[model samples]
Target chain A: MTVARAVTCPSCGGSIEIRAAGYTVTLACRHCGSVLDVAHEDVRLITAYKRASANFAIELGSRGTLLDIEWEAIGALERRSPGAIWQEYLLFNPYAGYRWLVLADGEWQFGTLLLDRPEGSLSSVKWRGQTYTLDDSSEIETTIVLGEFYWRVARGDSVQCKTFARGSSYLSSEASGTEVTWTQLVPIDRRDVEGPFVVRQRYKPRPDLRAIREGYSTAPGMDENDLPMMFLVALGALFIIGILQNLLSGPSQCVSNRFDVVVGAADTTHKIGTIDVKRPWQFVTIKADTDKFDNRWVDLDYSLVDRRTQQSIDAYGIVEYYAGTDSDGPWTEGSHHGETLFARVPRGSYDVYVDAGSHGWPSDPRPDTLDPKNPWSAPSTVSVWLAACTGGYSWGMFWTFAVLLFGVPCLILWWRHQD
Target chain B: MSKRLILFSLWSLFLIAISGIATWYAWSPFADDERPTSSAFRGPTHK
Candidate 1:
């Protein structure tokens, strides 16, 4: 995390000052329209903003076509791009570790993944010398009833390669017919991810790792290990698709399921989180993106609670990482497009820190979903109908016809070898 | 046939199993008073 700058408000261009000691916040000037974010924890009063720096760095990377560069470091990325670079330093905490990032063209939009960890997170026995890098190119997802979600990098190319974890799970409500090809399910909260540990990619030195060239990989046909696996996948794909097709789109009714909500206390100024429901909906999920809001504000401030109860409810916001994966759709489009977080808690808290720079009731709970109109869509009804009537699976039949129908038959017709 | 046909075949097999169990409950011989019979159907003939 970069050292936060606590200076007089530049908008109204006046001297509005804030000096709270925990969790950084944004405070805006009622005059001149200037905005600033205060990193109360660092209190350095520095001039360099991390987001700007990241942008500049990313621009350099893109300009230089640094795809092969071991994606690491802020300044290094800045040097590679020929154009402008944008950088940002988001929230931080000792237990949840901290985040320092440099993105190419966010234009003032990013995500504040509202997940928390336990005490001594950096010093935990399992994290003394562990290494991790950003899982770039990984898909981020959000949806109407489902928001703030991500897919862990499973086997990158092979089917069933998505490392499905976190509570931002989903159920398919599409692709329910004989002509359909795919379906997805709601991810279950990985009860096993329950350590106060940070999630990072195993880091390697930029000079040592191979550069990224191919966007993805071509199927190596099906090796012995791969064929049996792919076959099982094909069949599981057929059956699981059948089952999920039933859950959200077919006939089964699932009762409201349960999930784990992890909320840890805060000590650093960069760590102010609360428990409160921002948007209340019935039988519908939600996701809130906090990126553009960060840019709209001019200043940040921090306020502490005397542990008082206001509004008769808990004076805090409980944020959940909405897991919206379209595993069952033609494509997991909106759900996996970006980072989203959902929290509908009451206002009862210990400390309330906010970047009050962007002020206003958040623009009418615009959640990230596939279709803005039909945001709460389930798995593909299209595929459900397909499986109910078709004999072999979609892909199963396609591949069988692909090789047997064409390849093998062609070889027989063209039998004579040149030799 | 398609994969759905195979699935239907498997489901039909399951249904057959279920019906077999249902028939056992309905037709297997039982202890005297428990059994439904022709005398019962006739409502007890006069002597």
Candidate 2:
């Protein structure tokens, strides 16, 4: 039953509907009160409703008055301040993974919204009640962030719904439970959890997590309990350290202005004369960067300009997950398997950068390949698939299945003892 | 003494003209720059 779209009303074209739960009062135009602009030019005025709840709203003015409320609205709570109470949320299961309600304890309905300054962080939501009906250009009050904790909803000693959050607002989820508690950082048996899921049918929440400012969050801190045996011992120690990181690394591909590492979830964002590498040297252009294909990045930066002595360098290309060669030639050291940058670097044609750093590097994107460089590399292990070229590359042919499974049994015992 | 100082100067000019019209009706129109509009809603994103 999701149908409510018809925005119009630039001034009085009059159409209005855009619901995610809003509208009950404060909109007079029996002919003209002119207070409209309900937003819907291209969206983004707060409208995330997968299941919906937190049912409550009261932003009336211009003579506010309307009553159907008989009495006791939750053991008597008729608050009169806190910006006058007019915000309550929850839009469908909120990503419905499961964590709907069980925070027991009666009459919830809390309030406190004040932030002229003082934004360390805060968000608390729970809403339900948007059948329809919202006029006068919508967008009454928008600001949302709700991870979880709401029990269905349907209270009315005369409609009274509002729940928790007053000082710095709260609700977060990075779950882990059993002991760790300081509001947990992770320990619920090493949580990386993603289950109890649900997507279109909506409702995907695993809740039981929090981080109001959490030292800015880099996001990772779990020991290991057995997430598929820690992903098969981290994918067999990254394929035996990617075979000595494929005989010494370099040239998975490099070029930077260091925009955090070329957007950071991994690396690789290239194009260096289409690279054929003949004596211009520094080749291996694109690989490494795989937050499961691509999960949005924030690093790697570069930008050169030898363009006949236009003379430029730009700087800050520190790529390292193991990152080795950025072109000083024949890549070596650590062989390059994950991240490496800012070493000698001087081939040419630059301007490759990434941002969102300081606390947002490749940090933890679940074995996504942040330090590497090819972005994904595998044209027969193209010489240590890059942190920026570590060197020693051999792939003129193709091998490494333990040399065709033990070199055909030692060549039939040396050709049956030399015939 | 002098017709009680002209009836205490007409009751101090009628209480200073009713305290200058209640301080010009509380600083004319609730200044805080007319305040009102505190939007807060965000659900459904990708644009």
Candidate 3:
């Protein structure tokens, strides 16, 4: 059971109610804003202030139910830091002792006295099983005090406070000379406390440590692992499907014809031969071979003209081979011959034309005394073979499209993860 | 339904749709073979 006692403020002679009765040690005159030390029988005036009282969202004497306990606001203290100010409302319950409701930057947090001493350094502390990081450490001074309090709190009383935070909970240690107190605070929603009290205004609370961590982890952005994993899965599936597609396709039937053409000494162009395509859909592969002793490259251009419609399609091929032995090992680059594939050709009678050109490094200087047998170092006789394969499926184009579809997201995820 | 269950279902549906689209594009019937192979005369040692 608790009883309220009425006392007169010595400075202003104004009536003041001490709700905590014997437990109350300080009272501020609501009429003159004077801090009074009520611990002794004769109330002593500690400080006098002329500043106007600031308005609060939760007024003194407001009753509210929090955490399944009934509490009444008995004292209000405004504390100031470097550039910020916050209010701490002392809430009392007959059976629950005292708790604190802190309002800072439109955010509310419920706090209770801590009995167990936490162990760790100033930067980090270990409590129970959780680790907390030091968030702030500073000296805070009380700028104003109103209503009643259990301690002799003056307007200019200062204390050294250190706060450590982990997720949504915070642990604060306050020291005055040799005495120290610890409090554990957890962020609370404003609606939870406003239910039983008449709140004039409500504001959104600032994000706690837990909320900030969740935002960083679960924000609406692509996950670094998810995109790459999806891409790999999609690529694997595509690779398997491509293999199956090729295996299921009809067997390729090829029709090959060879041609030998001799061009005039000065001319590089000549007519090869005529071909009769038998399938509706076929791939045409043209191969060229040239005889050369030293390193040399031969380029050939071929044109397929439709006999009846006079329509034509042009294609080209190249043959080059170079081999040398160095101290390291044997090295070879270009092949002696190369082939090209022209896909999806319609059946028609076609006339083929070939143009060949050769270029290479000049042969090593021949002995001046040796008689020259051949004037040209490159061979003139060119062997060409043309083959058409029907029922062939395309794997290059499909793989390109598949890689692009999956590779883009993978790259984006990689870039984000780097950041 | 619970929010978590609904979210899971939606995610599953999205993945299925993406995979389906990828499969369709990969196995397109109209695609032609344009890839080239090495010369028949060139041995694997040359590569």
Docking class of 1: incorrect
lDDT of 2 at A339: 37
Could you give the fnat of all candidates in order? 0.00, 0.00, 0.04
- In model 3, the runs with Cα more than 4 Å from the true position are A1-54, A202-419, B1-47
Q: State candidate 1's TM-score.
A: 0.16
Worst lDDT window (10 residues) for model 1 chain A?
A382-391
Q: RMSD in angstroms, candidate 2?
A: 35.5
Docking class of 2: incorrect
- What's the ranking of the predictions by TM-score, best on top? 3, 2, 1
Candidates' C-alpha lDDT: 0.25, 0.27, 0.65
- Per-residue CA lDDT of model 1 for A1-419, tens digit only, reads 34443454421113444544244466554432334555454223233334333223222122110112222221221211223333332323334432233232322222233232111222221112332221111222211010011222111111211111123321111121232111122321222111121212221113322332221122222111232333343454444434432232211111111121111111122223332221121011111223222101111222323256533211111111122225554321121111111112222333333212221122212233256567676421100000001011122222332343233323422332211
TM per prediction: 0.16, 0.17, 0.35
Cα lDDT tens digits for candidate 3, A271-328: 6666666655444556555554345555566666789999876766667666776787
Worst 10 residues of 2 chain A by lDDT: A181-190
Tens digit per residue, CA lDDT, model 2, A188-265: 111111121111111223333454234223223212112333233334433443453343333344332212132223
**What would the DockQ be for model 3?**
0.06
Off by over 4 Å in 2: A1-228, A248-419, B1-47
Which 10-residue window in model 3 chain B sums to the lowest lDDT? B35-44
Supply candidate 2's per-residue lDDT for B36: 28
